[model samples]
Target: MQDKPVLKVVNLRKQYGSGCDHCDDGHEVTWEKNSCPECGTVYACNDVSFELYPGEILGVVGESGSGKSTMMKCLYFDNEVTSGEAYISSYNNGETNVFEESSQQLRHIRNTILGMIYQNPVLGLKMDFSSIGNIAEKMIAAGNRNVEYMENRSKALLKHVHIPISRIKDEPRKFSGGMQQRVQIAKALSNEPPILLLDEVTTGLDLSVQASVLDLIKTIRQELGISMIVVSHDLAVIRMLADRTIVMLDGKIIEQGLTDQILENPQHEYTQQLVYSLI
Candidate 1:
């Protein structure tokens, strides 16, 4: 329950290239055919850095091609970082640089110390399984194959997420997109991770639904005392959810400050453009 900054990212960089996926390192490859091999590889994230304090909401806002999503992926270890480091502080307030962690330790961190919520709720869940089934599956995986403990933990998580105990038995196909999104949140929380990464959690929801979801996230974060990193294109959402906002363009951070300060008095030309566009 240490309350200092829980996660710190410094000088992080991620690049995509022709032979990158085939690099001898142990990165899982997810490159596409259209990904350029001839042209010099693009830098998805370049020297982006930030810190998330315990129980704080740090929002990242940028255009679609901005490195917001890439940065989040790096923090969660979904994507291999080309350079730089992210530090994860432990429950006892001990800090370990993620880049220096062993594979086994990294896996433990991913399962027990960090959680991620993606832009698309559907993309994050197992559509083939029911909501409860998906939760059970992930709990087992995160707990490293403890099926009995997973079953109990999954039920407890569903209860915590405010899912009706009755509806916990139903499949995702029976629920609306908002309900599905709540289920995803519950699954992510099953591990009781110290840090949570949210990538456009409001992506496809309407204004009213989005507001409710964001409010729920805020409530949960405060109640659990967890640090969060949220990336979204919506400045309004950023203003509502983030204690601080980081602005990015062309794979670089243009500015970062308290949300109110950035909103009230943007200094950078890019920041002004973004603010004006919002207006």
Candidate 2:
């Protein structure tokens, strides 16, 4: 890891609904999971903090509703964060808080500094647009007006992700689940962002297709050296891709360490269950 982080997030919090005195102060009052029953407030993400170093993959692993996906959304600006500070080294030299930036600035950051690959193909890709067109759409947002350059870049990226050149002009709707995801990967890379955020990229694929996508991710990391934050509920995925791992439950991190260390000797009960289940 480098001395300076590529991305740093501090005390990120996202909560739905107003809080009551019962759970507002120190959360001392009784609650179920992450919800404060008294006030109907859901603490989807509670003071999450972490860093992504240059050329490394940091995995956030947890079950559904554990806030991992919420955190990813907050990072990508798809969902607003209630409170937090996110510093990107490539954005204003890491001195400015990204969460406080203007919407226009956020758009620039999203288009230039960050690329997000959503779990659902529909969320990350346009089903109606051709695969290359999807990639061109992102490039267009990044201010690329040269048609030839965009076309060349799109074809190259699609081919890199194993999409056939013959099918590059086909709409994603005609592709298989895995092929659609590959096209999504190509589109996300259209901007050449320094940071890539992947949320459950392999969640719904078949076992073999999942392996292919996972391998493509590894190849991207090795070849491009782009920093990545991968969110998944599966430890196996984290174990294969992440340099470091954080285990979350109930919207809070309960355990974290190097993937090997966490797998070999989990410290939390929930983490232990996750590790043992791999057997």
Candidate 3:
């Protein structure tokens, strides 16, 4: 009853193949639409809805094939939602349906309003560019057009992530997985976006490294007052970082509540299983 969220998603749905008779993206059909061909039109995301408030962390959890990543993609506008509305804006009450926005508007929203750290660092960073360069590129793309401002922001963000100043010129491939992840974090923050999307950020890190990264993320979020949606399979990771958590299974939100509540007394069977799995 406080107020509306900075980002709102309503009855969102993403279906694969219901249109275009030829293209693969148009259909959920497998192998030339032969065996179980009628099983086309798969729904990667089904009637999903959520809200993210400024300076809040929401953990999105689900098992494999639960469409967690797909949902993230839809929110990021990398993939279009088949139905429903998504609103993202600085004004808590301002609502602009994402699908209704033009490509340019969506681009502006993506660059300035939101930043995404992908699960795959290779996909997230430029392998050929130095870490600093990659970060700078993002800053520029985010509207920091001045060269000096871009470099300074890039350096600050890299240092903020605890990356050594000396390694600023090193390409992502030259760094360890943990280092690359940090660089990705830096790149994502380069734009000073108010919203951050992290997908399985701790996937490749060891326990100690994961702890360090998590701490760094928390520090940044507190300092920047950035809202976030953390997509992860690890409840411990989510517990350490998220204020609230939502459990998704087979493309539906099965349960949602504060971290302690969900961890202490998960209402749904699937949520209970997930909590128990961490034990």
Best by lDDT: 2
Please give each candidate's TM-score: 0.85, 0.98, 0.90
Write the residue-wise lDDT of candidate 3 on 12-131 in tens digits: 888776644633343554533212255455666778898888789999998877888998888888997788898876733466687678888888887887889888898789999999
Q: For candidate 1, lDDT tens digit of each residue in 1-279?
A: 335568878999887764344432425544332232334467788678888887888889988888899888887777888889777677335465687677777777877888888877766788768777887776676655777777777788777767788888788777777778888898888878888889988888888888778888988977898888889999988988899999998788989999999988999998888888888
Candidate 2 lDDT by residue in tens digits, 1-279: 789999999999999998888877875777799999898899999999888899999999989999999999999999999998999999889999999999999988988899999999899998999999999999988888999999999999999999999999999999999999899889889888999999999998999999999999999999999999999999899999999999999989999889899999999999999999998
Query: Which segments of model 3 are wrong by more than 4 Å?
Result: 19-38, 91-93
- Considering every candidate listed, which one attains the maximal TM-score? 2
Q: Would you give me the overall lDDT of model 2?
A: 0.93
Q: Order the candidates by lDDT, highest first.
A: 2, 3, 1
Evaluate residue 97 in candidate 1 and report its C-alpha lDDT on the 0 to 100 scale. Answer: 68
Q: Candidate 3, after superposition: displacement of residue 24 in Å?
A: 20
**What 10-residue stretch in candidate 2 is worst by lDDT?**
22-31
